[model samples]
Target: MRLEDLLPSPEPVRFVAADGTETPAPAGHVRPSDELLVEAHRRMVLGRRFDTQATALTKQGRLAVYPSSRGQEACQIAAVLALRDDDWLFPTYRDSVALVARGLDPAEVLTLLRGDWHCGYDPAAVKVAPQCTPLATQTIHAVGLAEALRRKGEDGVVLALIGDGGTSEGDFHEALNFAAVRRAPVVFFIQNNGYAISVPLAQQTAAPALAYKGVGYGVVSEQVDGNDLLAVLSVLTTAVQHARSGRGPYLVEAHTYRMEAHTNADDATRYRDEAEVTRWAAADPLARLQTYLRHRGLIDDEAVRTAEDEAEAFAAEVRTKLNADVVADPRTLFDHVFAEPTAQLVEQRAQLVAELDAGEA
Candidate 1:
């Protein structure tokens, strides 16, 4: 089939307006239950609190660096909640919110950000890849893992997360092409938060939408309101179901905004106007979902207070754990890279050990 024939219109799928009013989903799509919506809201609130704490830690030098997903909680929470426990998630540095929501310990998730190790937790234990630092490299890993699952007759799918900046990487294109051709059970989720670091989306690409890139590879693609928790959950649920059913890979572009700077290291004001940030602040994901639930009588003042209390408790736990000093084992540097250490690596390890011994002496 020609690429044009497989391409769908770039219209976004949304089930809730910014004002918290219900909107009609496309045909065959049903609105989620109030129970599920409440659960999703709880996760989003926790994610917001987690992001806030992590950013504060960066400021206090408790964390080396942090990329806060302040306004994008809905996208992070919904993506993980939509998946089964057996499914794998490949996250980027900014996806700590998603990782936390997926049952990873908050301290473990921040281990790498704390500058202790490359990976804080085992990928095999939690079915989550190490939070990738290099741009778009995880996409290829996700595709390869999904293809391997298919070969092994395993019942699983992979959700690969990337940022707007990552979409520009060559690995992004290659991974998408390979997945589409191989019919890999993987979903490439691009969180387009309007800027690639300081560079605006207009500067990123002239394509109608990032999801359109999936169409070029003959992969099914959809766009959704990243701020709307319900909409993001619905869209991701459908995509995951499609992949699990042996359909080709899917691409989802989440239209969201980064409320904070790209990282604690960036000054967003250099590139974006305060007025634009103010506009997105008004559409804050956590507030929108809370408003929707309140309007539906699914959430009351008491429930809101309970959620807040829970978030506070989580933040406290993260703070206490992160404030503790971490001891580094120098030997770990030589571990896990290869079954047998290379001669050069052995030499480097010995030199480091001798230097440490001399200093101690």
Candidate 2:
């Protein structure tokens, strides 16, 4: 496709309106199946509740910090639901919800944020990178993995998730250029939630949208209504396929909002007012999706209850595990530092063990 043809639509694609009604579809945009929508609704309900519980945990001091993906649940869940089990997921720190949706243990997902361990779960086992906190760095890692998969003739693609703020990072650009040139089977999913912590999009870049950046890098790109789950899933499903089909890389910019402060430590009131928050909340992803599902007779009270029950159970387990004391071996710090221990490292490890032995004696 021509670069211009690959450029995202001037307006974001949407299938569900903010008011719980269906909207007219644009050319090339198709409604996701009812089966998919129903499944998404269930997971989204679980995801939103999980997000709330995580935020509560931070307040209760169980976690060192938490970046809640409250309003961005649509983006968070769709990014995962769009992918196959074999596909790899690269998530940002704010993507614990996505990690959970991908069937990761919630407590394990928060391990890095809790300052307990480097990675609580095995990335290779699940094909999920640790939830990244260093901005667009995951994008580069995803590209490298995608290239490796290509070289190995594996039928896999990588979905590298980032935020609008991450687009400004040099790593994000480098990854895009490399992926485009190498035709790496990777998709860069950017949830443009209107802020890079305190800085607004206006101060960040003059580009029409983040997806446009991909076009310049020779990657197919599109923008979707991030607040609309159907729209996000539709756009992302197509993007993933495009890359899987050897079309190089695809970038999707989802226009969404951050309903909470950057982290538990941030005071959002300092930068944005209540009116702005209220305005965005009016377009809440969960509410809109639920509305559409109910209107279509896809979900009823029983299904709602089922999702709530599951979410509560999920939250309870996370609370129980995280609140309990953890026992970790100090030797693990030395174990993975190198495949073959350097002489200095071995000596340091011996010294540490000796010190522990002396204390016991």
Total clashing pairs for each candidate: 0, 0
Candidate 2 local lDDT, 244-285, one digit each (tens):
988889999999999999999999999999999999999999
The global C-alpha lDDT for each of the candidates, from Candidate 1 onward, is 0.90, 0.91
What would the per-residue lDDT of candidate 1 be over residues 302-342, giving only the tens digit for each residue?
A: 99889889999999999999999998788778998898999
TM-score of each: 0.95, 0.98
Error of 2 at 199 (Å): 0.2
On lDDT, the leading prediction is 2
